[model samples]
Target: MSALFPTYKRFNLSVKQASGTTVEDTDGNTYLDFGAGIGVCNLGHRHPDVQLALENQLNQYWHVSNLYQQPIQEATAKWLIENSTGDQVFFCNSGTEANESAIKLARKATGKHKIISFKQSFHGRTFGSMAATGQEKIHTGFGPMLESFHYVPFNDRDAVKRAVDGDTAAIMMEMIQGEGGIHMADPDFVQEVAHVCRQNDVLLIIDEVQTGIGRTGKPFAYQHYDISPDIITSAKGLGGGVPIGAMMAKKTLRDAFGPGSHAATFGGNPLAMAAAQAVLKHVFQDDFLHGVTEKGRYLQERLNKSVGDLPVVSSIRGKGLMIGIECTEDVSHKISSLIDKGLLVLNAGPNVIRLLPPLIVSKQEIDVAVQLLSGVLTDEKASIT
Candidate 1:
């Protein structure tokens, strides 16, 4: 009997320690962390630079209410705005909070209550973000939700065009839908949405929570499409291993919230900003992102070649290090079986096994993971028939 809440389906292992991409359990068994805490640990667990930054800041101030302007907060805000096309920022404590800010900003800026989101898209779990999210299972039992959120088929510009109207406040979407099974939105579709927002005077809000800060081989995934969103929300991977989130906007939307309208106590504390600043410095480097691109191609090519003949493996998708393995019913069960051998992975949806490894993960680690996955998949297929 556990004392904790029963809502979270807990993992059976009691992890004692971790370094880079591996976690050591209480019994001294080491497991490779291919999941990266559901795409949070892009730079890896307790990176030396991240650790040093957090440790150095611990001796200083940890919490200061958002009333006073903090130096590191200003620096982080400037860094985020300068790195992307954003003009200002609103700091928060998690992806959900950042997304809530984005939603409120979008509605306040446009003065329209309705929002347009894509099918299978996930923003966050908060009330506003949860309403914007397209999945139904997550919404069960949380009824009478925020109304006027319209959902359209992803990658279908026609559906989006047909759905937009005068009441549409913003067209919010994930550049690459992460939790919705690693689906990639077409560049043309993204450009169309941008055009629609421009023509209708609607704000474009991008949820970059999972794909930002060099995770997709770019500072932001929207950069790949060259579409400038009016508002953007980011959190995962920004603070390396620390907790942080941000909602950025253009100059027009920046003034949507008055000082009293929105605020968070620990939104941009000194220590969290220090960790994020260090991560941004390293992750935004041209050489580092280029390495991610090369490694992405290498990993994709290896998987495609190795599993090309496997009947159970359907296809591999996604950009940069956020790759997904689409499997037939036969190969899906093999993922759980591979866990027994110490390699940890995740399922994006029911049929897709998602892999979000550390950006610093070596080729050898990926090779080992792939090799182990291949063996388990092969054995499972043999037994299925």
Candidate 2:
């Protein structure tokens, strides 16, 4: 009997410690981690730089009120602005908060109530963010959801065109739908959305909670597209495992959030800022990003070559390190089997195996994961046959 709430379908394994791309359980069993803490540990667990930064900040200060000016916050925000598309940022504690802030900003700035989101897209779990999420399952039992959110089919420009109207305040979407089975947005569709937002004077909010911070071989996944969103929400990898999320916006919207408009108690605290600074310093490097791109290609190629022929595998998709393998059968058992075999993976939806390996994963590590996955698929195919 566990004291904790039964929210998550708890895995039996207990992780005692974790390093680059591996985690050790309480019984000393080690497993290669492919989920990267659900795309939060981009630099891997306890990265030396992140650890040192946290230690240094610990010796100085930890928390402070948002009323006072904080240099660390300013520095982190500056770094974020310098590397990405936005000029201003609002820090929060998680992806959900970042998205919530974005929604509020969009609504307040435009003085409009409606927001356009796509089907199968996940923004967050909070009230506003949850409402923005187009998936119906998450909204179950949580009736009376925040209204004024319209859902259109993803990658359908015509649907988006028809969906947008005078009441729409913003267009929010994920560049690569992470939680929705790793679906990649069509370039044309993204461009069309951007065009519609601009033409209608509606804000475009890009949710980079999972695809930002070099997760997709770019500082932000939106960079892969030519479109420029008015606001971008980022979290997962920004703090390198530390809890931090930021909602960045263009200079034009700087006045959107006045002093009393929105604020977070522990948004840009010293510890989180230090961790984010270290992560930004590393991920902003050209060499590191280039390596991510290269490694992503290698991983994709290996998956295609090794498991693409397997009868159990339906398709392999996604960009950069955020890859997904769609299985013909339910992936719940497959994930558990892989975990038992010393490989930890994630399930996106019911049949898609989501893999978000740490950026620092070596070729050897990737090869090992692929081989293990191959074996699992082979056995599964045999059983089905």
Writing each residue's lDDT as its tens digit, candidate 2 over 67-182 gives 78899999999998997789999999999999999999999988999999989999999999999999999899998899899999999999999998898999999999988999
RMSD of 1: 1.2
* CA lDDT of every candidate: 0.87, 0.93
Q: Which window of 10 residues has the lowest lDDT sum in candidate 1?
A: 329-338
TM-score of each: 0.98, 0.99
Spell out the clash pairs found in candidate 2. Answer: none
Most lDDT-accurate candidate: 2
Superposition TM-score, candidate 2 onto the true structure = 0.99
> Model 1 TM-score?
0.98
